[model samples]
Target: MTIDTLDIAASPMPATVPKRSFLQEVIEDTPGSDPRFEMCIQCGTCGGSCPSGPDMEYSPRRIFAMIKADMREEVLKSNTFWYCVSCYYCMARCPQQVHITDLMYTLKRKAVREGYCRKSTASDAPDFSEFFADAVLKYGRSFELGLATRYHLRHHPLGAIKMATGMGLEMMRKGRMDLTPRRIKNVDQLQAILSKAEEIARQEREQGGVA
Candidate 1:
């Protein structure tokens, strides 16, 4: 008898199985997600438009299916979530209007919160996001020089020096990039609004609403 190595029966089962569906759990946890999460038509449009899809462990469409299949750990740990560049091509091309980019961002945040973010290039996105957010919170505007300096110094010091010598100097000379972050005159009011927004978000999360 000839063996069919590709047969599902030949595969080993996991020791433990999840008690709940991953997709359902996520929907319940994140009410802010597009209501069309379950409406994907398995089309390849989103993946085709994604510039980073070729480098991802799972394409956008495949990740949606994996979510439906309750592959929680695998999906969260995958580099696909972190690889999204927020170019919006996937979301714009999705026939189902699934907000693919938003879902990808949600996944990235969740992965980081759950301690699943990889300590490699896959982590650069979240690290940069943090620096950008901090810069905004502190100065009411993104300080590109500060963000770049912090990111590259922490990640690639040698490459940072080379970049600083090249594009950084050009930007400085053009007066496009500021060495010091400028605070908005009404920054205190902005901070108050931000604090209130955070409070509302916390309340919503506690109430099982969208985060």
Candidate 2:
């Protein structure tokens, strides 16, 4: 659906509605707070660079337009956020110096907040995104295999059993996966940083409600 299909007006600042665009908040929340959207010259450079553009419901260019139009709900609910592979092609090719990858990540954070995420199935582990976030929050580093196993156990108990049966013997033989997580020496410091960052983001989100 196009941004015009929505009842929202196409304006940077919506005077009638006390609403915040998801795009605007994303731009604001990113580290260094790059004005990625501000520099778009409508050259379609980002769209050309995006490998997944053809499959997307809205191209990167369209998303930018929608964001500028303050179509917050549409942007958040769309599958466009999940489709980004973080390739950074758009970021690298952008003539305007827009941090496209960072914007994609911001949209992902919004997707999580809006409960737009897909649940794990019987054969699948929990969302790797959640596990990744947890790892960052807890250890300030990613423990990929550990997080994957934990995610599987937490979200797909049956799958975990199957996985263990299938790979447990091999893992034991090779000593590839560890049951216990290796702790970082300065975990508290890492947690503190993550906690503060999360708090700031939460505040920004609260301030910038759906438009």
Compared with the true structure, model 2 gives a TM-score of 0.68
Candidate 2 global CA lDDT score? 0.71
Clashes of each: 0, 0
Model 2: pairs clashing at backbone N, Cα or C within 3 Å: none
Q: Single out the weakest 10-residue window by summed lDDT for candidate 1.
A: 26-35
Model 2 regions lying over 4 Å from their true place: 1-23, 118-126, 150-176, 200-211
For model 1, which pairs clash?
A: none
- Candidate 1 residues 73-120, lDDT tens each? 888888897888889988777888886777787777678777777643
Model 2 per-residue lDDT tens digits across residues 37-148: 7778778898888887876778888888888887876776666657778898988889888887787777766666665544311112126777877877776677766776
| Model 1 spans > 4 angstroms off | 1-20, 28-34, 119-121
